[model samples]
Target: MVLNKIEQLLEKYENAETTLQEEQELKTYFSQDQIAPHLEVYRPLFAYYKASKHETFTKDIPLKTKNTNVYKWLTVAAVGVLMLGFYFNTSKHITTTDDDLGTIQDPELAYNEVVNTLELISKTLNKGTATVGYLQTYNQGIATVNYIHELEHTSNIIFKNNK
Candidate 1:
């Protein structure tokens, strides 16, 4: 009768359908010295479970952390020094004299200066326009290739044999 009960409990345990009380009964039966001969294979597994239940962790964990506050303050101090140096350096070179204004008193001289500047800008723009001509030629070549592909597709459609 006990062997039949143990077999039923073992089947329920294998299918994960046994309650905690049924599991305790299985553990108690396996702990005894007279476990059935055919059930000896599960003895070691249950023994391991029993032994593992009493095991405890004994190692200490480290709690030391790095000092990043000093590095953060150093970065802030370096940026402050760089900004002060840049302000002082640029202030020393920014003194504007009357000659720096380039103001022409004569109207004719100002008119000639304006004409010369415009001519220079026109020549630079003409150089850029010359380069754009090559792009126009490339666009024409691509259009010719696309027209050829369309003609080939139309010809294939007209000459295609239908059975």
Candidate 2:
């Protein structure tokens, strides 16, 4: 009879469906030495619950006051400093003359300036390419001269071997 009741309470406990009274009953049952072999496994768990249930809060917590003069002043000062920094940053950009930012207002002039700059760059590149071409011709001439020198040197060795 007690085992049937214990089984029902154990089922309810695992499902978290037990009320405080039902939990207390289970805790009481486990606290006793007459626990069945299968139910012994749950004994320590209920014993811990029974032990923790007797504990009470010893200290009182203090609530906050409505007045916050110093704290409020500090918060306002922080916001003011942030606003001043933002204003200075933006104002520095705004105060500069149109000459500093330059001629986005004239599209044709910008286009002509870009074309002129590109032409100058390509002219310089062409001059460099022409110089590299002359170097390549000079390198080919030097290679041919070296090949002839090797052939003559080989022929001189053959002649000396014959003599």
Candidate 3:
């Protein structure tokens, strides 16, 4: 009778239909010293469930301290110092050749050069050829329209012949 009850409970557990009380009852019923031989296989399963409820972390060791913000501040300071050094080094060197001095001395001429480059790029993109697939589809559409016109013309010729 006890084994029958355990079997019913196990069926319900497998189907996820067992209540908390039914599960506790199953754990208690299986923990007895004398159990049916046929149900012995399920003994360890229930014992494991009961044992796991009391499982806890050991209290003998302390957790390590966290100082993540300090490391982040150090990284920021290192990057800032590097950027300052780079800026100072670059500022000391002049970037003008003899030709650049004559050309770049006027802001209006530099602006015109930039505008001309952009216009050239735009013109190149506008005059490009369509792809092979586009050309094929265009020719197919024209052929379809011509075929429809020929069919209409043939119908008109037959009507005139009948008259």
Candidate No. with top TM-score: 2
Locate the minimum summed-lDDT window of 10 residues in model 1: 92-101
Per-candidate total of colliding backbone pairs: 0, 0, 0
Clashing pairs in 1: none
> Candidate 3: where is the Cα deviation over 4 Å?
52-56, 60-64, 74-163
Per-residue lDDT for 103 in model 2? Answer: 58
lDDT at 144, model 2: 100
Model 2 lDDT, residue 14, Cα: 98
Worst 10-residue stretch by lDDT in candidate 3? 93-102
Sorted on TM-score, highest at the top, how do the candidates line up? Answer: 2, 3, 1
- Of candidates 3 and 1, the better by lDDT: 1
- For model 1, residues 35-125, the per-residue Cα lDDT tens digits are 9999998888778889999999989877877888999999999999999999998886687664667789899999999999999999999
In terms of lDDT, the best-performing candidate is: 1
What local distance difference test score does each model get?
0.92, 0.91, 0.86
Residue-level lDDT for 25 in candidate 3 = 85
lDDT of 2 at 39: 86
Evaluate candidate 2 by giving its C-alpha RMSD to the native, one decimal.
Answer: 15.1
Candidate 1: where are CA atoms >4 Å away? 63-163
